[model samples]
Target chain A: MRNMAKGSFKVQVLQAREGAIVASVNRLLAEKGYDAMTVDEVAADVGIAKASLYKHFTSKEELAAAAMIRLLDHALAFLATLEAQPKATALERLKAVARWTLQVQLAGEMPALPAQNSTLRAALAANKTYLDRLMLVSDKLGEWITAGQKASQLNRKLPPELILYTLFARACDPVLSLLKAGGKYSDEQIVDLLLTTCFDGLCGHAKLRLA
Target chain B: MRNMAKGSFKVQVLQAREGAIVASVNRLLAEKGYDAMTVDEVAADVGIAKASLYKHFTSKEELAAAAMIRLLDHALAFLATLEAQPKATALERLKAVARWTLQVQLAGEMPALPAQNSTLRAALAANKTYLDRLMLVSDKLGEWITAGQKASQLNRKLPPELILYTLFARACDPVLSLLKAGGKYSDEQIVDLLLTTCFDGLCGHAKLRLA
Candidate 1:
């Protein structure tokens, strides 16, 4: 009984430490961006030695992958919640994802990695757990896109994947930050404008000749 | 007479060397990104010593600035050519810019630098020459946007700057390369899809509600 209790305590401590490390790395990455944030800084923030940090993740690339995996998990969870709400339409779901992603950025929870690293790209590509959640979310969004197009709620000419990339680009788009930094619009106003631009035709009500 | 000719020849040789250094740096920067590319490698690629390379641009930052300045100059010239065309509408002008930009990228003439620099935000901001040209092009684009909105050609509900950024993002958007690299679409098809997404409502022919 004593040994079991001791093992349980050890497991809890390990889990707590791992959680702290993930949170610390995320904060550092968001603040300093991927290129500037070092593993030692992450370890220091987590109150662990660099060696302990290494024991958890082999390199900075892996740590970034883990952080992204967490983000994907959160996104999946958000999608599940939205799915459970039967009142939501397909366009509503996509808008919800965009709004949540913008909110995350505003809340300082967004990752700042530039997505330009070859090694990091390889790691993310090979990360099955992350890829699975990404695909699940992607597939859900893809269906919504197709449904919207069929219903004439979305554009039919554009491919679903192109639409997906445009939506994904919203998360890391520099314009959001630029607008925020300029203090030109309140957060609510910015989100509203962006949402309008994303779904509704930016052309308002104009009719153009079809070639 | 011989001395004057020799002096002019020397000037031409120096100009050629400077252009070569810039090209070498641009190539290496695109291949390895900003942080990974070394000045020595650039020098080696140009068949010159590191000291000789520094004679053209004092530092890596300066070399990069020169490259970016040249790119901006190219953009300005392209806009000039478009403006000179008598029958160009605002949409036609915008499309002309996009087409030229893609052609430049396809030709391997565009410098893929600003995305990787942490200091670029401040560096470019402090750079008077860059700022002047940037603002000039920005103003030119802004006028077109307002004209577009006024002509009932663009969606007035959306901000002009946002539209401008969206267009700029197209030049460097990774999606074009990704789709092309996937072997799924020809370069022409990819560019056409992107241009369509940019101008026409991605939502197809459906009437859009902005409110």
Candidate 2:
């Protein structure tokens, strides 16, 4: 019984260390982005040696994947809570997801990965946990989008994937950072303004014509 | 007279080489983004030795700034053309600028800079030519924005700078490339779809509420 107890304690300690490593990685990715972030920085941030970090994550791509997985997991949990709230319209649910992403970004937790990095893309694609969680989030958002369209809350003509990419783009939007850097608006105000632009656009009932 | 003619020929050759270098930098910046791009790749792309490239631009940041200055010069020229248009409304002129940026991006001539890079920002901030040209472009766009708002052609409640930033953000919008990658739409179709999303938004006269 004592041996089993000691083994369980060892596992618990290992899990806690792993969690700390991932958290440090998440912050580094947010601050420096994937390309600028080094494994050395991640190790130092976690108060561990580089060798030990390698024991947990083999490469910079793996570290990024771990960070993204944690973020997606949080997103999944947020979606579940939204799902639990009965009687909310699909548009409201979608907006909630948008707002949540903005809040996370404002809190400096969003990892801004470059979209065109092939090796990073390969790493993410190979990561079952990351891909699965991302698909879950995408699928949930897709459902809300379709329902909103059917109900005339969203523009029925816009493709669902376009809408999805727009919302995803918002999570890393330079406007939020620009507004923040300007020191002109509170976080809440910035969120409200960007949210409006994301949904209502800048035209505001004006008829749009090609240039 | 012979010596003067030879000097003029040398100057023209140097200018042509510099222009080629800047064009290569612009394309690489578009494809790989600023962080993932390296001086080695740039030198290789331009078919010049690293030392020879350094004779033209001192650092990677300078290379990026040179590309940006070139881009802004083109923007200024485009703005001049738009300004010369006899009867285009402020809204139409603004849309013309939007469409022009989208076209440049589609043509892979847009240099995608990282908004958060302090060194690059410092380089740009210190570049009088770049700053002057950028200011000219922004001031022109700002005038159109206020005019549009005043005429009630745009959302009156949204700030002019907000509108300016929104339009600027669309130049680098990931949605364009995402749609292009999907292969379901022609380039014209993709631009039109994105143009609608940029102006009409996804809501399409639908009201938005916070989640």
Candidate 3:
């Protein structure tokens, strides 16, 4: 029993260290994106030896995959809360997810999802947890999108996949960073503006002056 | 007079080689993005020796910047054409530029502009021709945005800079590629759909079923 307790304690410490490493990877990705992030730097950021870092992640690809998995996990958790909100409209839920993405991006916690990095793409494709959670998030969003389309809340003409990809792209939308760099708006204001633009677009209604 | 002709011929050859190098860099950046692209690969693709390639572009950053300058030049050229169309509305001109961006991107001629590559950013910042032309492009677009707002064509509530960035962002928009990847849409269809989304947005209008 004592040996088992000691073993449990060791496992806890290992898991805790791994969590810290993933956090550093996430932050580095958020700051400089995958191309600029270095494994040695991640190790240094986490106050671990390079060998120890390798013991956990093994490769930069794996490190990125882990961070992405964490992000997807957060997304899935957020989706779950929205799923429970029985009173919310489908479009309202979609907006909530978009809002969450902007908030995460503003807080510097969102990883810049690599659009064309082949290695990172391969790593993510092979990551079961990442793919599973991504699918879950997509599936959840897909449901809302279909519902919104049926209700005429979202344009039914667009493929639901386009809507999903557009919302996902919002997580790394350069407009957020540009607005942040301008120092003209608070984070709340920035999120609201992007949310409006994402759903309504750049058109003028002449009446409300917003689409 | 004979010597001057020979020197001019030599200069033409040098210019031709530089153009080939920049084209290769542009294609590679489009295919692999800035992070996956390398100086060696560019040299190889250009059918030149690494040493010879260095004679044209000193570094990868410089090469990327040159490609960006080429892209900006194309954009300026396109804008000039739009400016000459005196009968077009400000909104029509904006849509033309947006369509041109989508077409250029689909043709694989557009360089993936690095959003956070610090080295590339520094090189672009230091390039006077690039900065000047970028400013020109921005100024032209800014004028259209102002005119459109005044005409009640574009949303007056949104800032003009946001409109400009949103349109610029369309050049690198992942939605176009995603839709293409789904293999259901033609190039013309892709450009038109993206252009409509850029101008009208994703909101379903009870009237047109698009914002």
Please give each candidate's TM-score.
0.89, 0.93, 0.94
lDDT by residue (tens digit), candidate 3, B1-211 = 5647457777888989999999999999998888788888998999989999988778888898889889989899989989898999999999899989999889988889669888888888898988998999999999999999999888788888888999889888998888988998789878767776667666745233245
Ranking by DockQ: 3, 2, 1
Model 2 C-alpha lDDT per residue in residues A149-197, reported as the tens digit of each score = 9999998888899999999888888888888888988898888888888
Instruction: Show model 2 residue runs off by greater than 4 Å.
Output: A1-7, A205-211, B1-7, B205-211
Cα lDDT of model 1 by residue, B6-88, tens digit: 57777888888888887777776666666667888888899988998877877788777767776778799989887898788
Candidate 1 local accuracy as lDDT? 0.75
For candidate 3, list the clashing residue pairs, or say none: none
Top candidate on DockQ is: 3
- In candidate 2, the residue pairs with backbone N, CA or C atoms under 3 Å apart (3 or more residues apart, or in different chains) clash, namely none
| Residue A110 lDDT (model 3) | 90
Query: Which stretch of 10 consecutive residues in model 1 chain A shows the poorest summed lDDT?
Result: A202-211
Ranking according to TM-score, highest score first: 3, 2, 1
Q: Write the per-residue lDDT of candidate 2 for residues B1-211, one digit (tens) a residue.
A: 5647557777889989999999999999998888888999999998999999999998999999999989989989999999998799998998888888999999987898887677888998998988898899999999999999899888888878889998998788998998888998777777777777777778875322211
Instruction: For candidate 1, write residues A1-211 as lDDT tens digits.
Output: 5547457777888878887887777777767778878887888788878998888888888898888878888988998899899988887888888899888877778777764577778988898888898898889889888987787777776767878887777677666776677787888877776666556545545322211
DockQ of candidate 1 compared with the true complex: 0.40
- lDDT per residue as tens, model 3, A58-122: 79899888998999999889998988989999999999999999999999999876689877788
Error of 2 at B82 (Å): 1.2
